[model samples]
Target: MTTLRTLTACFLTFLLSLAAAVAGKPNIILVMSDDQGWGDVAFREHPVLKTPHLDKMAAESLVLEQAYASAPVCSPSRASILTGRTPNRSTCYRHGHSMHPKEETLPQILKKYGYATGHFGKWHLGTLYKNSPVNPTAAGYDEWISAPNFFDIDPTLSNKGVATQYKGDSSEITMRLALDFIKRQSAAKQPFFTTVWYGSPHDPHKALDRDKVGYEKLGQHKANFLGEITELDRTVGELRAALRELGIEKETIVWFCSDNGGLKNLGVTGGRAHKGTVYEGGLRVPSIIEWPGKVKAGISKLPTNGSDMLPTVLELAGIEHQPKHPLDGVSIAKTVLGQEKAQPHPLGFWHYDVAGIGCWGEREMQALLKLQQAGQEVTDPKQLRSSGKPVKVSTKANSYPGHSAWLDYPWKLHRIESKKGKVSWELYNLALDPMESKNLTSEKKAEFEALKQAHLNWLQSVQTSMKGADYE
Candidate 1:
């Protein structure tokens, strides 16, 4: 009887330990940079810019080589990250649109599990007005200090609903706010979700005087752009150090990535066409995730995108609230855990309807007005469209010639449709040509035809989603 009692005690102790481990949910910090390119990092072979901090993080984290932004611009990519749905489905295919409040955001989902959620820096999804249901607070963030758009140095941010001034480099200011939130959450022994979205390396590229001095020697605008990226990198390093000091480094999952591709006009190119274009250079960006005890260090060649983040985080937090709407992204928890060999999804999609100036152009504005004027009964006006079907508009072929691309397995196709209805297609075997230099549409007509149809099909699906259809 004594031996049996001792054995039972040991078993109970083991179960208790296991329960403690399971209850210790991790703190999540998602760090996003604005307009940063895939090749901006010093470790990525940019000759002049120095990003030692990011380089170090990459060395110590899971580096995703082919990570892409869901959209070629800011608002859409960010929406995808929050919703785990395609930008079109989220009604955020444009640069300055708002995400619907009815949809659950990553922070909101985590909040149900007792995570203190805070969002700092850029919050371009929507306005911060109390009437706007798409603001940070409406989306489930408990504390928010954010801007409606890209802000430079010494920016003004809306704290919850009030505007406040913050001095110092934009990146640093954002990081400071996040660090403060982290400290508070740590004191309470509560898990936290903080998103530090830096508005650097975008337009009017401004860096601290010291940061610009080293690049001034290069004597080019590209050098200035590089300086901004370096400054952003430094801020990231500072945040990571803070987490370590708080004894949370090993228990925190820190994800670093860009909102979209680089700006070519700034002389920083990713591969082809910059910024607004749909080329890989415009959509692909650098991404790294560091969870000291959980994610194994090394490079992951898997083709991941911004949409995958929400599902991954939900899984990590042990929250099983599947989104009410169909999600285009799959949880990459297996890949993060080193149990998967390849990406879980078969294909990724990208699409945009408003031409030239992006999805939020005059055309889209007019469309919104028309919807309002027609008294179209919308369950969620903030959503792209409650029906998931594209509003039928006369589409002129080749209306947006700047850049557009579709990637399916080994083949990638680019459709550059100009303003005059002239559509030109460029095809590249991504497995063979990552740079997308060769155009094989003429040589491989059949393959080109198949890919073209696929691209159109994707556009159709995007249109459907915009109408607010529940697309899986």
Candidate 2:
């Protein structure tokens, strides 16, 4: 004899339980290393550099052999990863340029779904100190201890706009703080979305003596360079171990990648030329998505990049997200699960003519420290960047400068526009010439023309985006 009131109460209880379950989504940790090459890992047959822990992770997870960074440069790649759109759309056209205020970031979405979001280490997307409207918090992180650019030993970072000088290796300190945040979230029974971007193996390589022991056979600079990567590897191992100890490794998603390609001098790039170029060497990076038993193990030839991160993670969490603006990336969740193959969309890369805004890490940090010590709030407009405008590009119609590439898998096309406004084209069959040495524009006129047209159409869309047409 069930009463009507009892049935209603039961339905209400079920709704509450379902809401709680949705709130406890899987934890996601995205770790990115700066300047690490596609061949830097031991599994790639590197002559000396060894990454035992990363190799093990790759063995357990799906490896994207053809992974690309959204752009050949750092800031654009970072911006694309956060917003799942072309970086230039957000006004992050070059390094040191800040993201636009209107873009919806991954952390912002995750936080809305009851996740504790955090960002650690390099925050080169914008100025971290003083209230730049584009800082980590502005990007929707609940906690962040980040630097202006690629920082090194004993770096002074902004802890949510407060100047705090930390002691120890850069990656180590970043990981330690990230772990602390993870532990707190876990203790509170909250899911976390943490991003740890390490500043390692970047210019002016500084490595501790202990880490540089075996690399002396290489020149001092190369030794220090390799040593920094070695230390970065150790930090990665610790992060995995900590997840295991928490009994959440199987449920957590640990996505690892580098922002861009290796330096030309390093000779570690997998393709021709090096960083800052539109060639495979500059875009291709070592990427892995580890979810213990969830992600299928083995190599995936799918052409993916940082832009795919937001959509992929959201799909993995079973959260349906439709971006407010056009997305340059699509969800690769099926690919991760081994249910699908082949990239669903083509990736676009562009390097606009604007010069990168330079950021001096230590100097800026010291300046912030001085302001803090003087009991003055960060009111400097330059530090705040409220008036700092993006490089105006929409004013000129059909004025595409710098290099742009369209990677449509087997066939690739390049559109190079010199500062003098002279435009040229290069075509390569990547499946045949991975080095992109021999041009096939004249040989395969049909394929080249098709890609060239597609790329031109894409440029028009990108230009529209730059005009803020996509923002709702």
Best by lDDT: 2
Regions of candidate 1 where Cα sits further than 4 Å from its true position: 1-22, 265-267, 344-351, 355-404, 415-424, 445-454
For model 2, the stretches where C-alpha displacement exceeds 4 angstroms are 1-18, 21-24
Angstrom error of the Cα, residue 292, model 1: value is 0.4
Q: State the weakest 10-residue window (summed lDDT) of model 2.
A: 387-396
Candidate 2 lDDT over 78-145, as tens digits, reads 99999998788787898888888788999999877778899999999878865788789989999999
Compose the digit string of candidate 1's lDDT tens values, residues 1-472. Answer: 9999999999999877755644688899999999988888887887777889999999999998888888888988899999888776776657776676567688887877778899998887876544457778878899988877777777766677555567788888888899999999988887889999988887767777777767886665666677778789888889888888989898899999999888875635557777766777888899999999888898887777888999998887676786778777888888887887866353455555564222222233234345545765224444423232322333333243234567775788878755556777889987888778899999989998988887777666655655545644
lDDT values for all models: 0.76, 0.87
Cα error, residue 94 of model 2, in Å, equals 0.7
User: Scored by Cα lDDT, where does model 1 land?
Assistant: 0.76
